[model samples]
Target: MQFRLVKIAETSKKKQTFIFLAAILLALFTTGLFIMFLGHDPVKVYLSLVNGAFGSRYRIEQTLIKAIPLIITSLGIAIAFRMKFWNIGAEGQITMGAFCASYLALNYSYLPRPVLLSLMLLGGFIGGSIWGIIPAFFKAKWGTNETIVTLMMNYVALKWIIYLQYGPWKDPAALGFPKIPNFAENAILPKFLGLHIGWVIALFLVISVHIFMNYSKKGFEIAVIGESVNTARYAGIEIFKTIVLAMFLSGGICGLVGMIQASGVNLTLSKDITGGVGYTAIITAWLGALKPHWIVLVSILFAALVQGSSYIQTAFGISAASAQLLEAIILFFVLGSDFFAKYRLVIDWKGLSRKKENKL
Candidate 1:
């Protein structure tokens, strides 16, 4: 017998949900075994994870803080993915955004707080937009592979930030250490109810994106292009314009994450300002099915997982590598389920018989 994979043209919502639920249960059970092997009670370790993520107001706040950048970045990714644009340069876009915003913050420290902060946001959007446009322009004009170009741009952006931190932008006050100067108080984001206003911005973008993707004319054009470039052209959609515009919006939103992280979380520009959120957001965007509201839920869950795993390292004496391994196992199982939801494995007896006949 031979095995073949068959795509499911349509799966009921109920079936899809069941597959994902089963995947989660299986992931938990598998992780439980891992925990048991490590000499810890699985149930207790699981409880600790929940407690660490949301047992108290402080813990919940920490999870939300982690989710803020994730939510925004995933939203940006979703926009590009919706247009079937593989924008892998969120890292570069984010870094460039922070770098641009930092330039204004460091130079215009004398400006009023409101004005400087607003300009920083605009600068960040512009910086990221430009980075995103580079790949989109090439793809539209010369049929370049966006995936490779975007991936390469990430390193370019990283090198630029490293140069700034160690070279011209280095703070002389650091006493020979390579560090960028901290943003002035005027450049920093204000907090409301113990959380920086980034959470509010995240929520706003989620709603705005939902509307734009589902209701706007430009969004329809992007969707058409994603479905088929030929169809888009036949439908009179401006393929080049739409591609560039969609990417501009995608990269601009990602840029906002950089500004929020630099101004609200890190309080300064650094080589590590992104913390790999740009890459992580891709998983969230896909898992969320490129939906804005779903992205919020996925980002929060991912944030909880990270926060809980970190907590377990300290609370249960679990090593960092083990905690990360647990996260990887869960993600593996969950992502695998998506494959099964869309396709099924079948025994290809006819093909096996045909092969035997040929041999005979």
Candidate 2:
């Protein structure tokens, strides 16, 4: 007998939805089994997760706060991936954005609040755009491997922030402690109902991106280029320009997340400002199918996981790693199920026999 995997001509949206939901339910079931082995009730653990993420008004707000950065970063990643650009340097871009924005916050203490905030945002945008465009430029000009370049840039940006925290940018008034000084009030983002304005901005960008991608000529060009460079060239789509532009937007949005973190949440630039959101955004983007609206939903769910998992550790005595393990298991099932959605295995005993007969 022989088995062959054949691609499906077209998967219905309803089937795709069913498959993904099944993956999620299966992951939860698997995690429940593990919890049973650990002597804890799975239902209780799940309730704890829900309570941790949204039981209280305060918890809901906190979850939304975490979701803000994830939403922004994931949207940025979605933009790049739509163009088939693997921009792995979002972490670096975030770090650099925070680092650059911090310079204005730390140095220009005399500027008006509005101007300082604007300048800091611009700095963050410029910093992230530069980092993003570098790899794009090289890829466009020489066909350099963008993945490697972007990934390496992340370490470079990371080390730069670490150096700032411990070296020249270190706070002098901290009594010999190694840390960057916090931003001035003028540099900080304003809050609304316990959440920063970054959330508002993130939502605005989300809608804007959705409209831009779904209803613009430029978006069509990007889609064409992503599908095939040769086809894009045949259509006169300025391939190099589109690649660079897509990357710039991608990196710039990630940088905006960094600025928001520094100015709104952390109130300073630090090595930990990103909090792994850059990497998480990649997953969110993929899980969301690179759609802005879908990305928001995925980011919120992930944010809940992060917020709730910490509660699971404290409330249920589960290890912190368990949450991460849960995430991995869910991702595994979802990714694996995508294969079955796209293809089906067919067994062909007659074909196997014919092959064997010919060989004999």
- Give the alpha carbon lDDT tens digit for every residue of 1-360 in model 1: 799899999999999879877987898899899889989999999899888999899999999999999999999999999989999899999998998999999999999999999999999999899999999999999989999999899999999999999999999999989999999999999998899999988999999999999999999899889999999999999889999999999999999889999999999999999988888888889878899988999899888877887898899998756645665676788799999888989998998899999999
* RMSD per model, one decimal: 2.8, 2.3
* Candidate 2 local lDDT, residue 332: 87
Best TM-score among the predictions, by candidate number: 2
TM-score against truth, every candidate: 0.91, 0.94
Q: 1-360 in candidate 2: lDDT tens per residue?
A: 789999999999999999999999999999999999999999999999989999899899889999999999998888888888898789999988888899988999689998999999999888888889999999999999999999999999999888888999889999889889888889999987678999998999999889878899888788888889999999999989999998888899999888999999999888999998888888888889999999999899989988998889999889877867887788888898899799999999899899999999
Q: Which stretch of 10 consecutive residues in model 1 shows the poorest summed lDDT?
A: 319-328
